[model samples]
Target: MNTENARSQPPHEPSGCLTGVARGIALVVVLPVRLVWDALAFCLRQLWRWVLAPVGRALGWLIDVLLVTPLRWLWEWVLVPVGRALWWLVDTVLLTPLGWLWRWVLLPVAKGVWWVVDLLLVTPLTWLWRYVLAPVGRAVGAALAWAWHIAGVISRAVGRAVGWVLWNVIGRPLAWTYRVVLTPVGHWLRTWVWAPVAAAARAVRAAAREVRVALFGGSR
Candidate 1:
């Protein structure tokens, strides 16, 4: 039992020693980085608290004093007064005169011009289009439609007449000639001429074969 305990204890001692060494090395490696991070954080805090904050406050004060106050003064005093004066001047000089001219002079003249145009141009044109042009266009259209219908009828009649004439004069004669003359002639020529010629050709071939067989003393 003691021997076994000694062996196990030796293994655990080596592990503990290794653990201690690893921890010491890790602490040594991390110490400088931790110090550097802390120092940087402290510097950033001090910079924000002392330098940046006071400077931002001073800049805001300067802007308020220089830009914002002056602009507010200009808007309140200079711009407002000048704008009002210019508006009053425009209203009294230009706008008033223009309004008067438009109301009294231009309005009546424009109405008279419009009335003259309506009377001389628009009304006469409307009357012409309504009474004269519309009736004439309708009459011409009707006449053209009637003429077109009559022409279509005449064309159809002429086409049918031509077809009938062709069928009677040319088509019927050609059909009769083919049926009455050509068909019988073709049949007679085939039966008498072609049959005898084919038979004579066959006989000539047979006689030549026989003569050759006799001369050569062979079957073919």
Candidate 2:
């Protein structure tokens, strides 16, 4: 049985070491192809960079030349002339006639208004001053003088009572108002009127300085 089994298992065929040799040859052949592929990729990248650089610069220069320079020139030359022409047309055609109309028509109307205002305000004020306020003020002065004598006698008797009432009721509020609002308002009134005067004085001073510089060699 053992002899039959040995005979049935045929001898192992000779191993094929040629497959390993074929694999080594294939690896050696692929190495140069991979190197060439990597070299081509690098060259393509370098070429892309070189080409894009000039294209970007040219695009930027074209934008400036086409859009920016012409716009600036238009603003400086064309727009200015157009604006001046429009202004001249307005002054000659529209504004001149309007100004004439205003002088001829509207100015008389304004004068009429001023006359009416004077009649309403100044005439009444004058009449009141002459007829009512002046006589009433004189009468009040005379009456006050008479009352002052009587008041002095009574004040001597009731001085403490009047003083207490005024101190409690009126004096504190009056003092507070003077300190908080009236004092600042008085200061502001002086400043408001004086500031313009000061500005005019400063302008005069500047003109004098200029004149001095021109005449005296800036020594003053």
Candidate 3:
């Protein structure tokens, strides 16, 4: 009997309170986010349609029709013939003349001048050098060589005598004096002058260390 009563009851529907709460949450969280997204999309669509697309199409048409068409016609009609005419003019006027001058005038003249110089001046000068000046130069060079040898021998003997005198008179006496007298003076200077300076330097360093330790708060 209880089972039959339960089957006979109708299906339950949600309450108004829960449904109102769900609608409130949707308004707070989802509605504002969706509204903002729709506004941004509308703005972007309007920008592309009104501003960017028209400008892009105009620039593309200008580049293709106005600029590229005229350039192609100019290159074919004007530039090709002008370049060929300029090349022909340069070759006919400048290069041909220069080639003729080099082959006929400049080269022949240079060769003739070289031949004359060789025959007149160079051969005579070579003969003079080989026969006349060379023998005289050799004789003078032999005399100079003898004089240089004698001078070198005398110079070496004088240098030896000077060296001997310097060693005996100056160097030996100075060495002996340094060993006997100056050594004691140098030791006295170190013991008195240098030792006091060194001790002062060490004391200053120790004082600086103490000051640094005090400033930094470190153990001694």
lDDT of 1: 0.96
Model 1 steric clash pairs: none
Models ranked on TM-score: 1, 3, 2
Which model scores highest in TM-score?
Answer: 1
TM-score between candidate 3 and the true structure: 0.47
lDDT of 1 at 53: 97
Who is ahead in TM-score, 1 or 3? 1
Q: Which tens-of-lDDT digit does each residue in 17-65 have in candidate 1?
A: 8989999999999999999999999999999999999999999999999
TM-score of every model? 0.59, 0.33, 0.47
Expressed as tens digits, the lDDT of each residue in 8-83 for candidate 3 is 8676846889979988998999988999999999999999999899989999999979988889888888898888
Clashing pairs in 3: none
Q: lDDT (0-100) at residue 147 of candidate 1?
A: 100
Candidates in order have lDDT scores of 0.96, 0.91, 0.93
